[model samples]
Target: MIDVILADGFSMLTTTLILEALRFVNLAHRRKAFDWTIKGVQSQSPRASNGFTFSAQRSFEANAEPAELVFLNASYFPDAAASPELLAWLRNA
Candidate 1:
């Protein structure tokens, strides 16, 4: 299987959430087969509790905004629908 990475922006955007998940996943120390459903989201707004939320991290802080990837939680993404464009990018990246 050709495992090319997809939109780096998307990956970068999710890095924090995913890495945190990975750490928790590893620490669990058991081969669990599932995860709990996210709660408290009602709409498509970034402010929605269970959906993706993005914020710029450049204010006053020394880190450059473009260079900063911020993810506040794991429930940041919505349903995982594999679109054709995403597949293409993953295959070609």
Candidate 2:
């Protein structure tokens, strides 16, 4: 499965388009071509730069499931630097 680590303040358009394209491919092929887990740095929901927010399937701390592929999604101009906890998680992952 693909693990998508959506950083806080991610672009809504980027997230939507990627997921939509994946969904379309699955539908057209009539099979589960891909599976994804959207995760946040923590259990709290992440928000888009436009103030839109959504719940993640899991958090880095809460879930240790190994992933075949991992992706980081973040919008421009992040307000904060990557936390040490997140850096550690990435290193270990």
Candidate 3:
């Protein structure tokens, strides 16, 4: 499973492209080659720089099991959205 950690003002285009690539791989293999979940650093629904909003499965929690792969999508002043909890989670991950 893959975890996509979204930050406020993330790049929508980049995120979608990554998702589509994974989907393509699954289609080519004719199996569930990859499974992914969207997670937020602070808000459950993080807004992109283009003003598009994405509904994340959940917020990053300390107890949550880390995924095999992780992607951090952020743009435009990402530091503003960084929290201690998120930093800790990333460090432990």
Candidate with maximal TM-score: 3
Candidate 2 TM-score over all chains jointly = 0.80
Model 1's TM-score against the true structure: 0.25
Candidate 2: 10-residue stretch with minimal lDDT: 72-81
- For all candidates in order, the CA lDDT equals 0.32, 0.75, 0.87
Kindly list the per-residue Cα lDDT of model 3 for residues 1-93, writing each as its tens digit. 999988889999989999999999999999999999999876899899999889999987767878989898877767976777767777777
Candidate 1 vs 2: which has more lDDT: 2
Q: What is the RMSD of candidate 2?
A: 2.3
State TM-scores per candidate: 0.25, 0.80, 0.91
lDDT of 3 at 62: 64
Q: Indicate the residue-level lDDT of 57 in model 2.
A: 90
Number of residue pairs clashing in candidate 3, backbone atoms closer than 3 angstroms, sequence gap of 3 or more or interchain: 0
Ranking by lDDT: 3, 2, 1
Q: Between prediction 2 and prediction 3, which has the larger lDDT? A: 3
lDDT score of residue 80 within candidate 3? 75
Tens-digit lDDT track of model 2 for 12-83: 888888788878989999999989888876445888778988789977663375578777677774435377
Q: Which stretches of candidate 3 lie over 4 Å from their true place?
A: none
